[model samples]
Target: MRRIIYDVAVSRDGFIAGSNGDVSIFPHTGDHVDAYNERLATYDTVIMGRHTYEFAYQYGLPAGAKAYPHMRHLIFSEGVQLPADAEVEAVRADFTTHISALKKEQGGDIYLCGGGMFAGLLATSKLIDVLRLKVAPVLCGVGTPLFANVSERIDLKCISSTLHESGVEYCEFNLQ
Candidate 1:
């Protein structure tokens, strides 16, 4: 079975975005961008929530370029529409079934590019196999957290970790 991995960046205080949904505080300096691009290359599919999609569409990736041409892009949203030129598709509401079928066809691990809500759903469903976080140095004292309502304790074993000169730390963990 293909693993579902949440690849997200959060503030030191564990917020994914600040109040008012601002993630502009995230640093784009040093080797972090290059390292992220490299990590993204390993996955054949990038799964995201509507908000995350909008954020990427606005900030991280350029439109119409098919940035990860070799990979399939899947968005989980009830109302969001995919761009005509995008190599992207919206996953059906029957998330579990659709995700399962996607895994069968893709034959590689799935990268969950998240917004907290989406990550929480996957976490609650016990569908995520890995959680990879890029911790930024700054802290948003009050903001959207990385995970919410994840009452069950899910143990994770650290696979690797790297601290960058730009004060961003990357950590990979496998759900155990």
Candidate 2:
């Protein structure tokens, strides 16, 4: 079975993005970014909430286009309508059931792309298996938190960690 990995960049204070969903505070270049890109290549499918999918619009991504052309896109939203021929599909199925089935499919590990609320739901449900975080040095005073609406504490067993020359810390953990 494939696992779901919540791989993302976060601020030292525990925010994924700033008040306006801005990630400018995070380092965009160097070994940290290179490592992130390399990890992305290992996943064949990317799942995310509607907000995270729509957040790409500011960068000229069309409503139904695939954010990562190399990966299959699964956007979980009840109201999003995409063109019939669009590369990505909008998922409106029961979250837990659909995701459970996805994990049983034959493929590379799934990438749990973000928007804190979605990550929180999966976390609380014990569906997220791993967390790969790129901890940037800066602190965003206020923003979308690392995980929102998590009902309880989720313990993590650190698998590995490294501090890059760019001051970004890369950490991997298994959900416990």
Candidate 3:
């Protein structure tokens, strides 16, 4: 089966974004960004929440288009409609069914680029196979957590770790 991995960057305090939904605290420079870009190349498809999709489109889409040309992008949104774009698709159905069908058709790992709510949902349902997080040095006192409302203790094995020159530490945790 293809793995569903959540590859996100979070602050030292475990927040994915600041109180104002600001993700600027996440590292985006030096070897960390290079490593992240390289990691993204392994996936054939990228799945993301609506909010994340919007944010990416607003800030990162242009750059992402150049970096991940071969990858298909799927955005999960409840009611909002997606523009008719060749590079992006909006999925409005059940996540499990859609993801399963996608896996059967695409036949490669899926990267879940997320906002915390979607990650929390996937985590709660045990759908994520890996949790690859880049821990930044900054701290967000109160904001969206990396895994909000995740009740069960999902065990994970530390696959690898790397400390970047920018004070960012990348950690790969495989669901065990």
**Candidate 1, 1-176: lDDT as tens digits:** 78888888899998899887887889977787789888888898888777777776665675433446777888788977655776678775987677767767746788888878888888887788999899999989988889866778888899999998888999999987
- For every candidate in turn, the CA RMSD to the true structure comes to 2.4, 0.9, 2.6
Ranking by TM-score: 2, 3, 1
Clashing pairs in 2: none
lDDT over C-alpha atoms for residue 89 of model 2: 79
Worst 10 residues of 2 by lDDT: 77-86
Pairs that clash in candidate 3: none
How far residue 24's Cα lies from its native spot in candidate 2, in Å, is 0.9
* Order of models, best lDDT first: 2, 1, 3
Pairs in clash, predicted candidate 1 = none
Local distance difference test, each candidate: 0.81, 0.92, 0.81
In candidate 1, stretches whose alpha carbon ends up further than 4 angstroms from where it belongs are 60-67, 83-86
lDDT by residue for model 2 (1-176), tens: 99999999999999999988998989999899889999999999999999999889898999789998899999888877778888997789798778999999999989999979889888988999999999999989999988999868899999999999999999999999
Best by lDDT: 2
Write down the RMSD of candidate 3 (Cα, Å).
Answer: 2.6
Runs with alpha carbons beyond 4 Å of true place in candidate 3: 60-67
* Model 2 regions lying over 4 Å from their true place: none
RMSD of 1: 2.4
Best candidate (score: TM-score): 2
